[model samples]
Target: MVNHNTQLLSESETTISYANRGLNYGDAVFETLRVSAGKVLFWEDHYFRLMASMRIMRMEIPMTYTPEFLEAEILKTVEAEGQKNKTYRIKLLVWREEGGKYTPTAKDVSFCITTEILENPFYTISGDFYEVELFKDHYVTAGLLSTLKSNNRIINVLGSIYAQENDYANCLLLNDKRQVVEALNGNIFLVNGYKIKTPPLSDGCLNGILRKQIIKILGQVPDYILEEASVSPFELQKADEIFITNTIVGIQPISKYRKKEYGNTVAKELLQKLNVKARLG
Candidate 1:
């Protein structure tokens, strides 16, 4: 089932025109959310981020897009597919109405909601051999627009293809300044002894939902110190541990980067706290 502008439709009935702005010009912003047992995890964070992204892109905000209203619409889409009782990955996309060329004729927008099943209902640490390499073929621009979750991600698509061809689990992206920004799919965090560091949004990393949660979780833990600062490629080799955070995976520890291997002791501890936070929410 798919929810198109509050209307429910089957997969076969759901259709998009070629003139759609989102499809033609990449004029869209989206949120990837986790729904477990009919509840959206960290919904407030997701909702606010979506609203902010839309505002940044100059997309018209619908008067009816209150947090409560959007949440109900997302749950409605999940229920329509009989996934209200299970863990599901939901994507809510908002795009400008089709019109004009580079200049849109209207500020009005449209939306869609889609869902897929997820294996885990809460955060978990995987022991698989995950490795990553730097994707230097392209660089993300360092600015406010680069932080928005808009559908202008040719760099990510190319990095994913590079990772696949090189037999790597993931790839880290860099900004035009050549600073390590984030992973292809999510935000990156590096751990060294008691210090934990992740690139700030100014560095061009996505303002990830799970990244915010983990930052909060780390703040309450006196055992480790968290820093929202710039990260360089040289630091990746010296870090004691490396982990990536996103809405879907929660936290994924990188096992190797080049010849340097990492341990998951901190990743495991945080995964437990993350699960607790999810359940309490």
Candidate 2:
């Protein structure tokens, strides 16, 4: 128990696959989720997205896999990683493997359940802040793999590298039209006077789990329906405070965007309420 610090799958877990569709043609789908307090939040939604991706790709997966099983795996991984630390992150990866040649085989499946070792503290809007910039060189559109969470993440990797080189925390990615679609990994939320707005899925966004959760949580608050539409760069620049949300980061506020200071504190309050609801939701 002490030796196994985390419960994630390594490439050595399996022998040579049959035809190796996953390795040969990059035919795989996966989900990244957060494990905390011995529970996986919004497991159902993650499953829904995974299944949707599979359906789009004409792949089959075990739909009957219970939430209890997912919880058990996540707990096992968390305990393995955080044996004495008591906190960890989990990444459950499912690969569509064993298909022959370039096409998927009749019946084949393989998976890796890896638990990356956790660090001292996770980043939330409540913690040390970060800033972003409007990236110029690279962009992502909805036409190619936009609806699927495939193994292709080269765009995000390049964008992150560019941000790091520029001494920024993250990069706010826009489409060809240069409108605010999302962050490299998460979805963006712009705060105006008593209103919250985000880019619609039509604007080429990932439709993150936390993004949906935030909208669901905020939609019940009477005045705030948390609408989504095409959010332009001009409108985004005028925002009070901008925040991004995804699985691991939870929620993070941008103190500045490309040296432009957004002096609004609503992100802090929204994050506080969001954390409370996430814990109790």
Top lDDT: which candidate number?
1
- Model 2 scores worst on lDDT over the 10 consecutive residues at 1-10
Model 1: how far residue 216 lies from native, Å: 0.7
Highest TM-score: give the candidate number.
1
Local accuracy by lDDT, each model: 0.93, 0.70
Off by over 4 Å in 2: 1-20, 81-85, 117-123, 126-129, 223-225
Q: Quick one: RMSD of model 1?
A: 0.8
Residue 209 of model 2 has an lDDT of 85
| lDDT tens digits by residue: candidate 2, 1-281 | 21121335444553545666666676777788765565565778887887777777677666444566655666665665546354455566556656456655655455556565445234355455577888778777855366467776778889999989988889988887777788888899998877889888877888688888888778776655477888888886788878888888777788887556675476665566667765664
Stretches of candidate 1 exceeding 4 Å from the true structure: none
Over the full model, what C-alpha lDDT does candidate 1 score relative to the true structure? Answer: 0.93
Candidate 1 weakest lDDT stretch, 10 residues:
119-128
